[model samples]
Target chain A: MQFVLKSVLISLVLVGAAFADGIKPEALSKDGAVTRDRHLTEIRDIMRGGRGGYIDFGFYYTPSREQLPLESQYGEHDGFAFNHHFAGFGAGEVARGRHMGALLWFDRSGWDGEDFFLFPHYNDFSLQRSVVTWGLTFTDARMDWTIAAGMQHQNLEHRGKIYPYEVDSLAYSWAHLRFSKLSAQANFYRTDWRLFRFSLDLESRAIYGGKKSGPLTYLPNVSLAMYNADEESDIDSMRITWEQNLYDQRLYAEVAIDLNDTWFHSAALKFYPDPSRMIGFEATCLNRVRMKQLSDDLVEEESDLLWGGAIDLLFARFAYNAAYDYENFFGAKGTFLVEFKFNLATIDGWLFNRGAARSAPMETDVVKQFDKNTKQSEITPMGSGSGAPKTIEAKGIRYEKAQPTATTEGGN
Target chain B: MKGTMKKISVLTVLLACCLTLSGCLTHWFVDSTTRLQIENRSSKTVVEIDILSEEDSDYKVWIRDTIRTGEKSRVYEEDWVGTFTMRVRTVGSDFDIENLKLDGGSEYMVLSDSTDGSLHYEFK
Candidate 1:
């Protein structure tokens, strides 16, 4: 057990070191205000990329139930509140990834098991999965888009060593099951709308795979969402989403959906006080219904209203997220997450071309302020309604301008 | 409970506005790409202009563009930040301007006026 723990930690460190490239772009000389904006913009870009292609470790505990009803007869269990899990996951881009990113990942989980046992041989290590994806991104200052294709292979089983029910049985016979799927997906981010701090996205995904040999099967889905930019506070943002899938169309439809076809509708309200600075709250209503169900036990569907608030903080390359989620079926649970991210593109100056380049920290802005005080030319932001004193500094020149209202560019 | 219903109602109205507000007028925000707006107020037709980034050749053709007399052109808005040089060619003569620095979020314009040998630079 100790060897496994040490091996996993060493593997994560080695993988990060192998993939990380060190090449920070030299900062160009710009007067203060512009450099500050550039720094802020760079921070936003790094935050947007979030976490991908990195090692992920997680632990989940639900003191409710863990076994299937049929397993009660085996009579080896004790209490109802016994759900516990620990998992490790790692993935990253391979060399010929091109502008299109290709990633391979592996994850394994041990359920209701202790991380350490009386001896290394007695520890349980069962659930396993491998997922591979290739994705391409298209970027415009206004709209960012991505397309990806993926395949997932999963294996689930029990060793049966303790019960000795199948010492002669084939490998993975206790609860052996293998699942695989191929999927193609496209995502369009909030890049389109320009009015009232907006975010509008449209997406679609097509999937196939499952059963061993028969006619090919496919499951297709589409989704759309519209909301305001997250920067606003009060009753400033609202989101509406609708997504649908005719699960009945798949070759193994019965295996995927119990009711018949499946569909989901959701609406949410997000409020924050200049959330860029502090905390925020959200309220959501979600309804998922299944079609063509033969029995109630075959389907588990719900229409729920949930509310949660999150407190988020950011410092340099690290951040923390804490939130509580509650619904009638799932009860209430609190989650705390911490992440540190590194972006190779930022270090290489790909983020700089977006008009915000960071070469100096806040100190440079102060120095530039002194330069402005000494200069005879007075800089004033035009049409500046929000009193942001807002202007962009270009080269050695500082100019101020009022922000324009967000608008769509063309005719419908 | 009443307060919650009221909040939901208001949110629903706002959502309706966000959805229906589309297919109207369009607007866009400017980013940090370098921008050059040039006006050929000079009496002689400005045949061509070339931009060169002194540090690297990452931007090659950004230096080669043509502008006609009395025509205003937007030139070389890209993601590279650096010190650049611009050369102007006319029917009879050429002018070389050194140390033309450019970066994102910066807007610059040059007007070529034959009336004066001095060059005009504008900034925002």
Candidate 2:
């Protein structure tokens, strides 16, 4: 681990030196005014050694929960053991030019071992994994073009508790093209694995009716295998996707299909009023058909259908996401997750903007309004003004201060 | 026929090169670098200095130190010296100079005789 860290640092220093000697201009002057050379001196003084990065640390523990079988009552056997996980992420960008920069990132996560039905014999077990990524990006502001290439290394846990001694490497390249009313990007990626995998993705966008109408976008992808572990396997697949924007760009409906032996199709609609607000619904079905011959020369076919939906909400810097999933193999299961994020800017020197701090009053107010509307049982004055509170009564239950425009909102 | 084709290809390549050269020559210019400083008055210290410029620009800055602290009735003299060239633009940004050691103890403790120990600078 120390060797890898040292190598990365040495490489960064060498690359930075090479880039510095190749891009800096001899002097800077504009028009007839030669702002005192002091300007250059001051600029140089300020541009030296800027460092910024993020650190995240959290612990999660899930207590064992009871599970009921389809035909039997709830079992009392010891449930899956509670596990603890830790993760860290760090990234830094070293500016090379006004529009060009180089970035390096390291991410690592690990968890203490817990019992698994599949590996029942194991007692105490643990897993550790980490990934390091480095890349350089160049942007041509005048031409609205950007190009980036990066390499990533993943060290995944192997057998027992030790991670893989040899790290897997992946390389990716991407380019973006921008136009007055349209933009497009093409990306290519390759990973070195037992069975090498590569992918190519293309996406395009078209603007209509300015920002209010949102942009029309389409993405179509196709990948071909250069090599596979099993030569008998299929070598190509294609996917087509389309999205229609509604309510400005806040809401969207999308449909997509993947064409292959195990053909899959799905359709989803989403409403994202803002980054902190969202509602979505989706349905999907996958068919995997195969022919089997019995000893008596009999043929049979089997199929399965899986579908689910999820809803996520973020308020006051806290996010709650819940999902309901069902499968023929696992029956029906529900998952809920809640997390609170600490805003580093709140404590950093850059927290204030023009002497005003960013406040979450609107977010808090919206959450409270939703909670009150759902729980209120008595009519009460909303407020004293032209837009005074409206009373809503149903089935002898009165909801005070109900908005006239209150409507049922539902999505997946 | 083959010889004639080769001659035509050569001329086409030469024309393309001439056009590209002309385009580049019309818009070649130098870029400038920016310097920024952050002073902490509460702490009477210089927190950071950053030099923002292209990677290849080779330049250096001179920082003069004038700080005094001590008894008002006594005569005192302070001399500062040292020159450092800017290197590595990629790492360029706010740099803390409090730890920079000079002929007179630590740079952060220099102040005028009438004032408390404080950070001061003269950029050139």
Candidate 3:
């Protein structure tokens, strides 16, 4: 056994040296220009550096609506509701060339009083939701591999003004291989928790054909997760989801089922006109039956089906999104979101241009001309004398140019 | 039983010797044949170096003068790894190679970053 171990160590050193020798010293440059293929560079850039932090604020408003049939006599008055959300995201690479980075994210959202009252009286309390997430990612360009591990905390308002928090830990990794006319990717993800649930998911993708024709397609994905309230309790159940994309890039569908004394079926469809715009609709039906452990006698329960739709639009420097969701047991809820984004450096350039225009000095030129027909005093004809005022044409001129335009330099 | 044990021990010793020889031979061939070529074409002066380790760590870099031709000399030395950058600026017309070197086992070379011509280096 010792001999085998020694041999393995020696082999590792040899392989390391071989790889090191492959590094072309001449290829090093300080200009930050990597002499790799376009696709490879794209992947490398995504994993290379990390961003500091970002502040995001969002507002959503949904009008009151109702669910019909089962609760025929129930009607909720039309009311306006709003939510404000704030988040900060940051990440950094700790190890050199190993492609390792850590990410931290925090988000908080609150609902307005008017929106809170739209629900049942017992549920009429202001809501505050917050989440904190931390993750570490490992990336390798040569091997085309990336791995990430993280944990998250989610808090929601409960029972009037009380807040309850749920914690979850997750680990995920993805590997992508490139070929001449095709590519494949494998992804593994797992999340474990006590308050919420624990789940494991594995996904694979084989992409063939070109961007336009060969059918940009996908198939159902599989996942197995356990849900329970607490330890030592037999209230555990398994949940599964299957999804697929069809009809070029125009449609997407998914179905989910849980096997814990409850039957749930869900279907969704997405319509995408182009790369930047999409509309989607989804519905879910759920029925809960009494389990032997909970109650010896089986009883039939009411079935609930919920439906919703959403629209998303991506613009040059802004995005617009709207969604409407309705649950049979609750009232209808909707959200409208608008986001405006611009690079900090670009804004600085705009401010500088404005300042330059205000600080510029204005000057005008006046020219005296001699026209023989319009001269008030005796004037020489063309080429008749040398001392006469040179014939000149008066033209208006501005000393300053207009504000600096957005020059198309260094554009992607 | 005693005879069989003796025979097995002898065979094992012989096999170990043969495997060791083969491993050394493979390492020799790999090291001798591995070569990396770099072409520098930039306006700034650049020092090219290789990080020859699987471990992610910094390599020292510097310059030292090895050969002198008239007023010119070749410099080779190890440079500080943290302060080192891929590109460096040249002050005069002459390319002073003796002023830069890398302190470790890795191979490195300095060249003018111009597109007019190509610079080549051979490692043995």
Candidate 4:
């Protein structure tokens, strides 16, 4: 284990050395406010992807659950009230030409209080995932049709306790098929009748030696296959989504059905109060369909409902969620989350462009013209000599008049 | 236009019904990675290094094994973030550094031996 960890550490150093570019010196020249904001924006870009590519960093915590009576046959296991501490980083980028993209994420969840727990019984784990996508976009004057094929590889260092029957570790790879269509009407923002944008995504977990660890197993359906301990692979899922936007508001609906014998439906309404999308709010509801095994011989289908709301402010977001007659694996009811994210690619283009403008020096000609106009405007009159109309031809200049004039030209 | 609006309204209601009728269990959260490098300059070999969170002192983000004297440790990345402090333990002495800033990116620290048997440190 030490050797493996050392190897990973060496790889990280090599990777970091190769991409040693950190914050630009100019950005750090000030009190580092630019550096901080840029970091936040870069993380945001990773989540939503506006700046082509980004390296993301974030932290989240989920409160511990109340103690519950254990009925395991082994012994009375200490269900110590331990909170979940998670930290991870992901980097991804899609080419500007929409031809290819790749993403990688490393996530680690540590049980903070269980410091000295013995391994084999209680172990440490990490997950690394890599995905590559190839896409093609067909666009005409009125609409865009996009199709993509992708593959994702997932590696788990140590299998969690949830999957008890699993061996020491697991690795699997899968394929994805995605298609979408955006009508010209949707882009026009017309109040009149128009077709909603539509998209569909499908994943076949059965491909590429699905769930590679255990013996080869086959199942009948995706739903039932998800829960079968004997059949670890050969599962699939499909999702369909429809979206519509009207000026500052958007409506989205989606349904996903998994071969693991589960289904999910969700709908969301989002409002962008400002044109920049720096501040926005969204209300969403989700419903899940599950195939639960109630007894050794009996199985049943169950449904759960949940609703949530989220608010995004510049570089941060807060969300609150509540489940209806539903309990999580830990029996928690509601969750509150705080996140720092900004997608310079989504709707913060203007803001980031403004930042770019601030960092980038002005052209010499523009600066000279600006200085000349400012110096002359202080002494110049609205109408020079005899109240005739005046035309100031200074580029990039704005004139504020005290009174209305007959005619004005040149200056903007 | 009115008919289209009516259809959309009905579709929206149907979508809501779908959400109200179906379900699963999920919790969404994002975790961050933090990188740190330590250079041990003390004459004594260091045993363990503990990284404690500022918000929750009891929380241990990482417990590193050992750093021999005059040895520089490689950059270590952990699934952790937030403001933190460090405690370095040697044979019979321990050193504590408060308010250590690790900007969620990369940080380097150099620990040196002092004439009076204390530890001096600086961040790079």
Candidate 5:
């Protein structure tokens, strides 16, 4: 029943607007100025210091389509302005491996669907989510790491008037769902490219761990997860990924295979024209193969493919995608996103060269000068009384010239 | 199903091969010798210079006699390899360079006296 509802809702939303493309399911940890991959950003924090803080606001729009899931109804489409707002702050010194950060994010999106089974019925559903997160980082002997945790609250509700469909089972006013979850994640970065990560969803008791290590040229990271610990089941999912960054981090390529009951894989490539990553271009391809049990002894298999690309400007981004769904839910879609970013400050990096200090060096210049003066006094003693030759002590290293007696030259 | 299973098998084998290769490439490829030259640029003479290795906690005396002003100490090749702490004593003040990593190359440590009667040192 839950799977049927989800499928219907997806199809309902598809009819009204082009589905947003290139937005991963993972919750973003920052204000979107940094890279979308949170793991890479964390590594950058330890390797190149951190971005202090920023705020971002984004708007999304899509065009309406005439085709509906029931084939007899039509849906209206509208764009949402300021659909997402995010603010975050992070700062630390990489050498000391000390960092702290916080984030607050809010997102809202709505879709409209209308159908005519017995009578014309209108359905308006809106999804609103709020998330708050905090993280702290510290250093170890060989690795620098951090731990972050967040809470997400979601509300899915039907808004505005719902026309009575004359059937008790088809009433839409009571349709609503509220979900809340707490999640925690930890990351350990040993070097620029070597890392380990762990995440846990507290409400669902789902846990995942991943590790990546190797040379910089080719690194493989793998993650494994179990959705529920109390249930009797094998591992529910495993993710195998290979990521590479080249040309001074201007080009990035990634291939990921996610295995569950179904087989899913995605390959994505991104290029950044500037160092700040305010402008970029990216493309992605996704494929999924699903197996379903039709009966006790029968099974069915289906495959879906999606390919998309996006161009991100400094303040706006445009994305388009073509999809082939086995159930023919989504065909093609375009999404327009406008974002504003404000950077509060930047974290300054400092060097750490502290250690146990030994004692100072021996034999100073004062001691050497004292010894030389004592030796000079012992080598020559001055005679006393009038008319006697006077002796002068030299303060500097250079000695005075000797004076010849005039009486000795006359006698010769 | 058969094709998916075959792809998973091939990727697993490739991951294992990469990890094994990483283990084999752990050792460094080159052997290097570091030559250090101490230059006394201060007005006062530097009497004694010492290099202490953090790994062994042993102090190797590099310069015992007085290094006169504007004079450069002979090239002192580091016999041991590791992070080292260096100490220099002049007539007026003492200078220190702590937790320094000297890799295969030539390094220079210049000791100079500041106007405020303090010692300044820099490694290049």
Candidate 6:
């Protein structure tokens, strides 16, 4: 653990240094005319930070899986996992994972789906567990409200060797698999008092391909209920959430997924306290605190608050993200992500140091000195101006005019 | 019945490829450091020179040092990029430099002491 932390710190310092290397201190953080520079009118527009969504490719090294075990059928898996967080598309995000996969909707009014490809039997290639789905979604005008339902198909393979016994476990099997169903969803969003915001999603799915459904064994436990391959089953779920933001969307929510098929709910709150994306904090609370328990025989069990955060950086063409997840069941897990996200149009120059997208270096300039008795220029602050902010050149950094702090009526 | 899924698989793969090909890298790659520096230009070394930012009437010090004449002292580092009110204090008197905008640039607040014991500065 110490090694991981140390390595991350070392990487941060190295990356910072690498980016700072080409920067000539005297060149820019711009020093423009006093009236314009003091107002800082262009901070929000600095480097086009908040424009379109970006496509991010990350290589993640996960060392702990007590909470959500990875490839359990295999050994205790802890290694580098290639992760693709695809955004910049229409409204939905299509992400693929090997052991597990899901495509979620940021704005449910759009289309979305989830397809999981579990294991291909070690001995038999044909006997594999997989679920595939494709569907369109509906969203409201505010963008906060949406509805989406995709085709949920599941082809679960229970080979004689894997299930050894006739009836293994229902919840375990259901997770590694899915059902062929037509899914429908509806989500409503509301923000009250401008601080408390919540959204609720209602989903109903109809199971398909339930042939002469096979043998069915359900434990008395509610969490283990499942439909016999011969019976028809569907999943109806509801999700309730409350969230807030801070620091101009940088350091957001500082406060705080699932059940197999029945009515399950989960909620999460995350904060990026540092606009630089170097530091983050988050806490999550979910309904199935029972399944992820450390022991099954506990007399009293309550939902758990799974919390985690990350420090991320992008410099000199290299991107690195380090995160720590604190799971009561898993204790603590360390994960590090490394990868480069490049624009398809600029891929040729993305990795090349001399690439076309590279920034031009400036000539070193001298810092002038003032002699005794020389009258200095008077400093004047720029007040409310009718002119739009102008982009200024600051040797190494780009900057703009500053504005007077606004007077917002509510919230601290 | 599972044919629908198979048919979409081909489309999903092709769409994924197109999206990947058009991915973007949007982080700012500008190379610069932020600092507020003050260089003493007078022949005689000045003792106890301080720089302060007064926002909302609250006084926050940026640079505090005994600047040897002709030398420079960095009063603040990673200074914010925006409007600001500043003050330069010398052993003799305090001078107010009001409403200076910083566009994330490195500029020396060159200061000179007049015979009347007043301090004046320029962004050199």
Give candidate 3 regions above 4 Å deviation: A1-58, A63-98, A104-124, A155-192, A195-216, A233-235, A275-300, A314-412, B1-124
lDDT of 3 by residue, B1-124 (tens): 9999999999999656434421223223222111222333334343334322222243222332222211222333221211112222233332322222222233433243344543222332
Every model's DockQ:
0.00, 0.01, 0.00, 0.02, 0.00, 0.01
**Whole-model lDDT, model 6:** 0.30
Q: Write the per-residue lDDT of candidate 2 for residues B50-75, one digit (tens) a residue.
A: 22122224222223222112311122
TM-scores for chain A, candidates in order? 0.31, 0.41, 0.43, 0.42, 0.46, 0.32
| Fnat of all models, as shown | 0.00, 0.00, 0.00, 0.00, 0.00, 0.00
Q: Write model 3 residue lDDT over A1-412, tens digit each, in one string.
A: 9999999966754443233211111111100111111112122222221222223333332221110101111111112222233333333435543445554444333332223322322222223444444455554433444554454444543222222322322233333333221233332323223222222212121211124323333433344434343345444565565545565444555566777445464555655553212222333333323223335675545554544444433211111111122211122222222222111100111111100111111121112233433575554466767667667655696598776556645455
Could you tell me the lDDT of residue A174 within candidate 1?
A: 9
- Per-residue lDDT of A1-412 in model 1, one digit per residue for the tens? 9999999966754553333221111100111112122222222232222113222222222211111000111111111111111112122333222222333223222222211111111112111111122222221212222223233232323432222222121111000011111112211112322112111111121111133222222222221222222334323222222222222221110111112233323343433333121232334443433233457667555444333333322211111111121211012222222221112222121121111112213465587799978765656547645666767677767677856545445455
DockQ, candidate no. 1:
0.00
Interface C-alpha root-mean-square deviation, candidates in order: 29.0, 32.6, 34.8, 14.7, 31.7, 22.4
lDDT: which candidate is best? 5
Q: What is model 5's DockQ versus the real complex?
A: 0.00
Candidate 5, which CAPRI tier? incorrect
B2: Cα error in model 6, Å:
48
Better of 1 and 5 by lDDT: 5
- Cα-based TM-score, every candidate: 0.27, 0.34, 0.35, 0.36, 0.38, 0.28
Report the number of the highest-TM-score candidate: 5
Which residue pairs clash within candidate 5? none
Q: Of the pair 2 and 3, which is ahead by TM-score?
A: 3
**lDDT, candidate 2, A166-226, per-residue tens:** 3333333333333322333333334322122122223222111122222322333222222
Error of 4 at A369 (Å): 13
Better of 3 and 5 by TM-score: 5
lDDT by residue (A1-412, candidate 6, tens digit) is 9999999988865543333211111111111111111111111111011111223232222211111222212111111111222222123223221111222211000000111111211221011222232233332222222232333233333321212222211111101111111111211112111011122111110011122112221101011211122222333322222223333433333221223342334334444443323333444443434433355675544554433333333320222221121221112222222233332111111221110111212122112234222434332224424554644444677577675456454456
Which scores better on lDDT, 3 or 6?
3
Predict model 1's lDDT versus the native. Answer: 0.30
